[model samples]
Target: MKRSFENPLIGDKVYFTKYATEPGSPASIIDVELKPGGGNGLHYHKTFAEHFECLEGELSIQVGKEILRLLPGETATAPAGSLHRFFNASAQPNRFRVTIDPGHPGFENTLKIAYGLASDGHVNKAGMPKKLWHMGTIILLSDTNLPGFFSLIQRPLAWMARRAMADGRFKRELEPYTR
Candidate 1:
């Protein structure tokens, strides 16, 4: 099964072609379209690595302080625990295939929540959640680790996230996104 999600605020789209739950699929794969000058900020994951293969246009993957520039068919990887991000500096949209090694359904769900938040104007200019609790919930559910000083608040946010999950806030907020 394939599902497409869009972040209207950033003009980004992710088409989920394969997920862990799918038969014979070992990883979560997405065909992503990124708007010019748009992409995510630096973040790292502890559980999974990400592979990016440029399918069209130019793609730049930044791992640590090094940037790997790619043309069509080129690929780069950010291993687990590496701080990284991807961006499109061109004037047009760029398409790339991203595979999350070892697959993470929670990560996929976080994408859904993000897009839903953007559609509802609940995200900031950079497409991050405007609400601290919401951001914390996403951080917990998605296994996303923010860098540097931002990491300090992770614990408090996680605490709020646990409460949200137990109080049904998680399900209520995710319900709109899943459909």
Candidate 2:
């Protein structure tokens, strides 16, 4: 099955073409179309590796301290625990395919939640949650970490977020994705 979502927060169109739910399959296959100057913040995954292959336009990827400009057919991998981010630094759109290792069900759910929230206008202009509690829930669910100074408070915020979720405040909002 093919699922697609447009995330205004990150200025990207994402398509989920395949999901790895069986043994020995790729975690997930995603096609992304990034608008010019669009990208996500520097973050790291604790348990999964991400691989990116540029399908069209210029894809600028930062892995650790190295910046790579990938063209069509070029690829890069960000191992687990490595700080990385990707963007379209050029004047046009950047299309790319991303593969995640050790398919994570929570990751897919997080994407659906984010996109759904954005569609409902619950996120800011930058495509981030408008509420602090929502942000925390996302962090906990996605298992993504923000590097640099934000790292200091990530844990505490996530803790509070988890508490809020457990209290059932997010139950209604999370229903679509969770179920």
Candidate 3:
């Protein structure tokens, strides 16, 4: 696996610095850098929690209904099943460390796929996949759930993803990024 991943479309860079190799350590840890005005949409994970610790600049994270602005040395946690998002609203870049407890391999692969898609111009300007099946595949693998009414379509999206997997399309797309 690559040590670093970059989403040029969204101005986000993530460096995988730690993994669940130790007996008693973080499942996954990453150093993240978000360019000014760069951020991700609100979404929730079905498993694991993300502990965001700001390292430089300002990191704004919205966890559930509250928006927390963290500075250097501050930390905020987005527990599993909580709708959350993060961004860099500052004029300069924002650097933070995200620790995922009980790490998930699918989630890690999701980032690689998404970033690869962006680099290949398979995603839109907003960094979303251009194809529905691709979107479904990503959502299925990432454990990411959309908010509100969009959540209702999770089943259908998952179905599409499963179909792709069954047809070997998923393997074709994922193999380049993962294994």
Top candidate by lDDT: 1
C-alpha RMSD of candidate 1: 1.4
Please provide TM-scores, in order, for all candidate models, with all chains considered together: 0.94, 0.92, 0.93
Candidate 1, poorest ten consecutive residues by summed lDDT: 170-179
Ranking by TM-score: 1, 3, 2
User: Which scores greater on TM-score, model 1 or model 3?
Assistant: 1
Task: Report clash pairs, candidate 3.
Answer: none
Please say which candidate is ahead in lDDT: 1 or 3: 1
Which sections of candidate 1 miss by over 4 Å? Answer: none
Q: For model 2, name the residue pairs that clash.
A: 9-127
Model 3 residue 142 distance off true place after TM-score fit, in angstroms: 1.5
Q: RMSD to the native, candidate 3?
A: 1.5
lDDT of candidate 1 over 59-146, digit per residue (tens): 9999999999889999999999999999998887899999999899888888888888999999888777888778887888778999
| Clash pairs for candidate 1 | none
Q: Each candidate: what lDDT?
A: 0.88, 0.85, 0.86
- The runs of at least 3 residues in candidate 3 whose Cα sits more than 4 Å from the true structure, single-residue gaps closed, are 21-26
